[model samples]
Target chain A: MFSLLQQAASTAAETDTHAAPANAEAAAAAAAGQGADAAHAVEAAGAAAHAGEAAQSAGMPQLDVSTFGNQIFWLLVTLAVLYWVLSKVALPRIGAIISDRQGAITGDLMQAEEFKKKAKDAEAAYGKALADARTEAGKIIAAQKAEIQTELNTAIDKADAEISARAGESEKRIAAIRDSATADARSVAREVTAELVRAFGGKADEAAIDAAVDARLKGAA
Target chain B: MATEADTGLAFHPMEQFVVKPLFGDGPIYWYTPTNATLWMGLTLLAIIALLVFGTRGRAIIPSRVQSIAEMLYGMVHKMVEDVTGKDGLKYFPFVMTLFCFILFANYLGLLPKSFSTTSQIAVTGVLALMVFVGVTVLGFVKNGTHFLGLFWVNSAPLALRPVLAVIELISYFVRPVSHSIRLAGNVMAGHAVIKVFAAFAAIAWIAPLAVLGIVGVYALEVMVCIIQAYVFTILTCVYLKDALHPSH
Candidate 1:
């Protein structure tokens, strides 16, 4: 297993080294090419100088400028300018944009976390408030129920007392009326008995009958 | 020792190092350095100087210069934020260094006959290696043994485990190749096209073809410069994101 792993590692190393020669060749080509361009420009300038002299003989003052070196120089200068542009200006701006974005994102994440915490707190408070309200409502309901029960009991007791007092008064009045009617009834019965006794005086039993009649009349009156 | 070609091309050097000959390439090359190394060294120095000057006092209320400095910081800061989220902020210095280095190197190469460090595969490979090793190490350090779990992804069913693992491993290993190749290819191809066009102007009297190529490549190179820098930083962010949150 170790050997197999080593083989794999060696293969990877092999691929890495394989790229070296090609890179060196390309670098050589690039460096050599630039040198060749510069030499060509010098040759062209020398040719132009010869041509200008030839033209001057024909009544024209021709100028010969080495576009070759100028181009190379300017190209270099342009590259420098580009480097400065990116390093000093463009990159900095890009960097700023990136940082601002990061700040915004981080700020947003922190803000979201804060909001979530607040929401949780709010939910907890709401739950507590709800529970407290329910408890208070329960207490109020229980107290009211107890109070109503007590009130009903008191009202029932008052009604029972009133009914009993009315019943007592009614009974007393009935007893008094019955007593008066009984007296009236007894007087009528006694008068009828006395009348009847007077009508049959000669035919009635003597001393016993007189005593019974007197006792009954006194009791009836 | 000057060749006819050497007379045409100018001198510019950056940094120097040893190059051991592989197989039959003769003796090893030691620090008989060239212009390429010098420029690379100078590029590094320039970057350091700018950053140092820019961050000297670090005022909350920025001056004109401070604004430019802050802008650079902000750009990298934003890139990290977008790609890596809040955790990216911790890697601000590193990411910024990378962005500035890449941007400066690219721009510097555009100077007349200047060496492009990124044009070389060794340089690109080194950069890619730095990112790869750095990110991988960071992943392991952050997640410990859990980082290995990033390879397996056994979250899938038993039936698919082998296939997914293989695919993930291939992609993971491919990161450095693609990263290095992309930067080096762009730089190389861009310079090559410009060189070819410049050569055409030297050879023949055709104005349109050479001029168009020169102008067009100039514009294209400008875009590539920014794009490559962005690509580098963004990838860094993505790698960092993976490091911080390895589940993905």
Candidate 2:
């Protein structure tokens, strides 16, 4: 690289026709010391060095007064445009978008809270309704049990009365049989007594026989 | 170094900072569009794209570009509020303009062939001067002669107060000069060092180190660029606070 730079400087010194910039003069002097091809390579390097020098400015380009006016002018123009655009359009728009997002989030959170409350309310109502239905069911079951018990007691009482009435009728029938048997016996006894009397040539009294038979049936009973 | 072109290793670092007409070689009028103008215009377009068109959706869920815009907005907004207090918000638009412009200018200047507008002393001087002048005016408007109390050190002993006042007054006046130089100097120094390192690539023995040095400096320059922009803005806010509440 050093050799090539020396070679370019050597040629540029010979070929360069324009006024020498600072670095080029030093390069030209160094090339003079080396003393090589101050020949046709001169033409080749001439254009390049000139272009480079044209691209460069002396000293600090930062302090260049010639460009200051142009820089400041454009700077002011750009700032004005940026300031106008920002203050009027960009800032307000961004602020609004941010606030709008905040509002949307707050609204969503509030809605979620409301739904949670509704769910809680529904749960409570469901529990209350379940309890009420259970109580009503218990009441109905107790009432049905009492009604069945009353019906059973009435049926048993009527059965007992019918059984007692049949027993009384049987008792009366038995008594009547006993009385008829008594009368038959009395007649038989009287007949017997009269037969005995005829055999012994004595007559028996019917009235007296009836009385004795009656008294004997009564004693035997 | 200029003759090193034959070795394919000629690097003019300051040449990159030169302001030239973009169209043709001629005298640059105050209005003639140059590379400086081009980069400045690019900065504006970048700011617009990020802070304007990027936020076109205005979505509740911000896109990447919109989030970046909001982040910048919130950062500067909070800085102003923190330093200058609530009253300072009245000048938020002004402060926002300064921060965004400097930030974009610094970042854009880092491009391969881009010119750094913030690295220009003339430009930073104008920026600092605007802040200094505006704040001074605001101080007087807000608190008449009592604004001068900023220089008067009541905390000092009566015998030492005058000495402190003189120091305060000079430091107060030096604010704009230091403000402008600090930014331009840092950026210009970083860029110039990188260029010098790049020029070393002409020698084979040092080429690797030169490339590494360039990379390292480039990274640092990127950091310095944003930091300088931040420092410039924060200093402005401090000055504004002093003006708004000068009694202390």
Candidate 3:
């Protein structure tokens, strides 16, 4: 029987509790009689007999009522210990580990999502900045072009005014010069006519000469 | 005796199932430590090592052992949630305890010369009773009079309702018996069958075939161990669901 193999080494040889428990106990008692006291020996023998009877009554050890208490008791003890260990230490620790891992994963996922959102926001900002810069550059170019055009128009207007003023001054000077020349020519002609009339024995007519010079000049001679 | 004398072969496979003292040939008391205790202790230790110590790091990227522990946790957690819905998650730890205990017990019992403690009806009976009682109390507390609707199928024709109620009532009561027996029976039968096959190996002519049978049976038993544990836990979840939503 496995019972013998499971026995303590010292008690194994003393108790051959395999086939017939009563017989095994009797043999055990005989062996113990040499070493143990009489009182203890009797008690040991009796208990062994009782155990044998218990075993004898039930063909299957599982159905044996005698051992039910032991099995259940140990089972309860084991379960209680298991529950305490599990609930107190193992389960909670495992649960914590699991939840912690889960939390870690979720936290990472959330962070990744935040990062993606940030990236998207940055891209949008970059695009807006590019568009703003383009618009600003466009505005600058338009303003510069308009200012240069206005300056060119003013310069052209100033030059045209100066040219017109110069032409007016030149026209007045030419009129003065023509009048002087006409006067000079009229004096010279009067002097020549007076000299000729005096030489031809006739008095020079000053008023008439003057009137003729004036009419000829007015008629644009 | 006659059969043994005739063929010099006596195979009492049930003898292996006998509970005996571990230290000395003394009477087994309710508190005496036996092989049952040793194996159960081992199971406890294994759980501790895997769940507690293994997860000490609790790395975001889990270690191998921690991953295994997590896998078990996830599976049982999901099973409870799936079967019982959101409300059942409150009982996650309780369901987890049952699944781990039975799973470890079934697995550890496969060790050589080890006593299969879970093979005892008393042990499994207590486990099933705990679940049954706990679930029943929870049902009443949660649903009150509505819990009885589980047995009183309203959708049935009025004439057949009573018959169906009787049947449902019987089945409900039979849950613990079947639940306990299913685990113990599977474990015991597999071990016993393996032992019987081992016995056949004592004969020289059939030794090889018997050995092959033993290997084959052991392999199948290994699968049965996990599957039975799964079935038991899933059934517990199913029962919890019924208790939670008793109208169906």
Candidate 4:
């Protein structure tokens, strides 16, 4: 198509150049007389040719049967190159990066989960330890309370036995003093009755005096 | 429009889409590189810059380009998995290539004077046909005879089953056509509309309005470019899902 257009353009140019010198005077006079009209016709022709080319190439080049093979060939080449680059080079690298990031994230999460479990276990152990200490403290307190109660009971029993022994000894000593005083009083009453019988002409009754003194002393005690 | 161009007040919008030979005005042979090839090469370079060179760092903490590369990778990967399930992820590379190629082509077309490779039906058609062929082959390979069950509507009444089956079969075949046309049509229309508005910007009275129209259309084209790429990739995933799991 391009060759044909070039041929037509060259032929037209050749005719214009060939005819110009030969009929220069006549053509010049004619051109001056109808210059605008001639120019209009030439412009119209050029525009028509341009419009024809444009129209030929215009609406859809895909509909053109002649260029299909070339277009298809180039398309295949480009697509093949693209597929090679994407599949072999770009895609695999990108996929690797994404999966690597995912793996890192998953690893971190697993570690965190392990830490959480450890923390939970530690908390449970601490709670168990605290409960054991409390129970042990309670047992210690109960044992000490029982021991204090037994010691208090033993001290009370010893104090009560000492007070009873002291009371018994004091009672025996008071009885002995009372008996000695009563014997001394009986001797004094017999002596006083004998002295009275010597001084006067009456005989003293020592035995009777002694008996009375003894009876009086018994009543007083 | 012809008179407008004749008066030198307008431009040929479709001229941009022409597949001219890059070096000379020679006839384009099958191997002759053209403007389409140049832009496609550029798109490939862009992909290489993003995917291969950008990810050369391989950093655990990605650099800017690496970040973008990774984001694209993750986006397409997740999209495939979500749309087609884990079993369908085996085809992630193919789907990713389709997405990146179309996406870069569409975006590169937005550059001044750059040709949109995806805007051509030849390109989009090939891509869609590849997906179709790949998915269909995968279906048969995985499920063997059961792949045919995709066309059968068992839930339908006995009388309506065959009718539903025919409809399903036609729609299934039509997927490639619609898929190719949707991308090419959208990209071409957007670029052509922008060109039209740009040409109208030469007019003094409506120059501001024309500029506004171009801006609006360009913005919409940006969105359309990305969305069309996404649509193509997702559809590929859906088809792969059908291939992997050939149930209703």
Candidate 5:
């Protein structure tokens, strides 16, 4: 491989010398060809260099003791910057925003709870007021009912007293009539007995006639 | 073309990861800006654009960019809180920085001719180590000597407790190794596979197949890019939880 590469390099050098002074047209074509070759050579050289680099970077550059210092230094610097940015600037701002939003939510919830409690209290008060009004109305109705009942009782008592008074007057009149009738009947009986006695052939005795009429009257009573 | 063909093309897939000085080739000093530095700087810029410019509005009703910024913020915040509980939230900014840097680095690497910063174990190692050290220190500070109980499985049989403790101690030390490699390995492997597929494009007959392969691998890489970032951050949260509450 080494001999072949040497041979190719020598040949290329000879071609370059010969091609420099050839006819313009031929030199142009040769130059073009050389350019292509040169481009290819550059590419090959780059590939070879990359392969060398690969060999050097093989295993791990991390394990390479020589570069550790550089790597660590840069890492420290970068980490320090990143940490500062995060802790000092970015995080605090974000944390504040989050906490602020949470605070707002909690405040709004508390306010809503207060409103709900107020509404509940109002409802309870309204219920109590309604119950009180119902009781007052109930009492008024009962009181009116009692007043009407008492007035009815009083009117009934007055009517009973008047009726009793009228009844007593009628009873007294009836007693008086009965007494007069009795007396009239007694006189009529006596007169009748006398007339009967006179009509008879024998003279009738007044005492005997009076005694018979009294006895008859006593039997009738 | 024929001459060029005589000189066979040597495709190097790993060449993309070379960290050289950005300016004229010179010895890379510690302060020298390199391809790694360039890409890392770009990652930082991308983060700034998203977190700062994107959320500059701070509107009650967010715009598209603002919404994305807020979503990323909420995602990391919730992850920290859920994994580490509320105590873990204090370190949210640190975790967020690591996530954003890795996430952006992985994504930016997908661009044509872009370098993947997270593909380097050095970067990931440092990140993982920071978490390891921080968590360890926090464990001691918070729990005093009782933090050692984390490795001691008290629930195990008394005879087996010591055995389990050794295993736990070994695994505890291995946390940074696995954590760092998981991110770097995933990123590097995906990128390397894509590079290999890309290199095949040089051949005439297989060029179309190579393009197709690249497309498929690229799609997978996109998912991997975000997932690796999430994995790294979540692992950090898990480790942190152990430190904060190191009883069992």
Candidate 6:
């Protein structure tokens, strides 16, 4: 099997060498004539060579170009392929990435602006809340002070009424004491004069005597 | 118009200028034309004109000139992307600008009596050296001594590492030489071929040779101009990729 494979490889190599010579000859001939027929003849010769080789090589005939020319040709082809791939696939992706980064920067700026606005609003809200707290506290303190003052005023008025009623009752008690004392004192003196007149048998001018005696007793006391 | 023979092209290498001043003492700097400076100046003017025209008014959608500029931008952008994967995009502008400058210089040289800036070895060498030094500096700056990993082949077995490293080192050092030679050789050879064919046009019997030579050389030169530009840009992309990713 290996020998057969080796023979086949040698034969393939031979056919490739033959095919290249034929193509080169045709290329030289085509290059020689500037006319239209020469162009067709070159193509026809290449086609005929390919056809003849195709029948012998199990449907896989090697190409008929020098390795250097082939390399140069393929270099161009690969370069074009590379250019296409870069232009179509890779470049757009990179451009998108750059655009995305740019968008991110702009978005960050806008977000910062938004956050600044929010912060300002929060500051205003806090200020209003603090102001409202101060006003509410002031109102509460004022209300508390008014309630305390009213209670104090009510207590003072009740204390003054109690003191006034006690003073009036004391005065009435003193007036009663004075009037009773004077009436008792006058009756006691009259009784004392009658007893003296009854005892001494000289009961004349009791009122004058009583008056003189009362005057003399009052002067002595 | 001086022909090749009259232009002293037959002089030995570096004999185009010789000082012999006993007969009439003089300075040649004043009389000798500065081809290098003159061509560079012309290229700069061309670049300025292009930039001025292309960017006269910025548009989201491109005008003709703008589109042409964008097409160039797109070409370099894609080239960088492919050769360097995604990372090479950062150097797109630099690489693209270089490609555009060299390409325009080459294309302009194809015109009658126009100088090819890249045809000169010094110019090509300087540009290649810039790329080489830039890439090397970037590798060192970004990766430090670890950039040597590019040549170390850490993936290789320890036994084979020395050999691989040596080979890679040689190849790495040869990059600038290859790059400069490839561009300079292509441009110089294409121009030389064209010049030879143009000279052949003066002969009657050699008219056919001239025609064939002109057509083939012209066709080939056009391809060479574009390929050299692509190769230069792609190499830049590859070098930048190495700078960015030192392991490979």
Which candidate number maximizes lDDT?
2
User: Candidate 2: which stretches are off by over 4 Å?
Assistant: A1-58, A153-221, B1-11, B23-29, B152-164, B246-248
> What is the alpha-carbon lDDT for the whole of candidate 3?
0.78
Per-residue alpha-carbon lDDT of candidate 4 for residues B1-248, written as tens digits (9 for 90 to 100): 34453645654465576576788666555677888999999998998899888877777777998889888988999999999999878888888889999999999999998999988878888899999998999999999999999999888899998999999999999999999989998999899899989988887899999999999999999999999999999999999999999999
- Expressed as tens digits, the lDDT of each residue in A1-221 for candidate 2 is 45444444543343233222433453454455432322222222232233233222122455455567788999999999999999999999998998998999999999999999999999999999999999999999998998898898888888777777777777777778776776667677768766776667876777776687678777987
Question: What's the C-alpha lDDT at position A13 in model 5?
Answer: 36
TM-score of chain B of 6: 0.83
Give per-model TM-scores: 0.48, 0.74, 0.78, 0.78, 0.69, 0.48
Candidate 5: residue A203 Cα off by (Å): 24
Listed per model, the TM-scores of chain A against the true chain A are 0.48, 0.56, 0.62, 0.58, 0.49, 0.53
TM-score, candidate number 2: 0.74
Local accuracy of candidate 4 as per-residue lDDT tens digits, A4-78: 233223333322332323222222322333334333333333222233343222223344344566677777777
lDDT of 6 by residue, B164-242 (tens): 9999989888999899879977887677677666666767788788889888988899998988988998898889999
Candidate 4: where is the Cα deviation over 4 Å? A1-59, A160-210, B5-7, B21-25, B52-67
Winner by DockQ: 2
Query: Per-residue lDDT for B21-140 in model 2, tens only?
Result: 888776667889988899999999999999999899999999999999999999999999999999999898899999999999999988877888888887888899999999999999
Model 2 chain A scores worst on lDDT over the 10 consecutive residues at: A39-48
The native-contact fraction of candidate 2 is 0.65
> Model 3, range B10-62, lDDT digits (tens) per residue?
56666666677789777777888877777778888888888888888878889
In candidate 5, stretches whose alpha carbon ends up further than 4 angstroms from where it belongs are: A1-66, A155-221, B1-10, B57-64, B157-165, B201-209
Across B1-248, the per-residue lDDT of candidate 5 in tens digits comes to 34346645444455566566788766566788888999999999999998899888877777898888888999999999999999889999999998999999999999989998898878998999999999999999999999999999989999999999999999999999899989998988888788878778888888899999999999999999999999999999999999999977
Instruction: List model 6 lDDT by residue over A1-221, tens digit each.
Output: 33322322333343333234544344343333323433443353333333223322211121222222322232233334434443454345445544655687899999999999999999999999999999999999999999999999999999989989999998988889977776577667767777777779876566876787678667866
Taking every candidate in turn, the Cα RMSD to the unseen true structure, in Å, is 17.9, 9.6, 8.6, 9.2, 10.6, 19.4
Instruction: Compute the interface RMSD for each candidate structure.
Output: 19.3, 4.9, 5.5, 7.4, 9.1, 21.4
iRMS, model 6 (angstroms): 21.4
Error of 2 at B69 (Å): 2.3
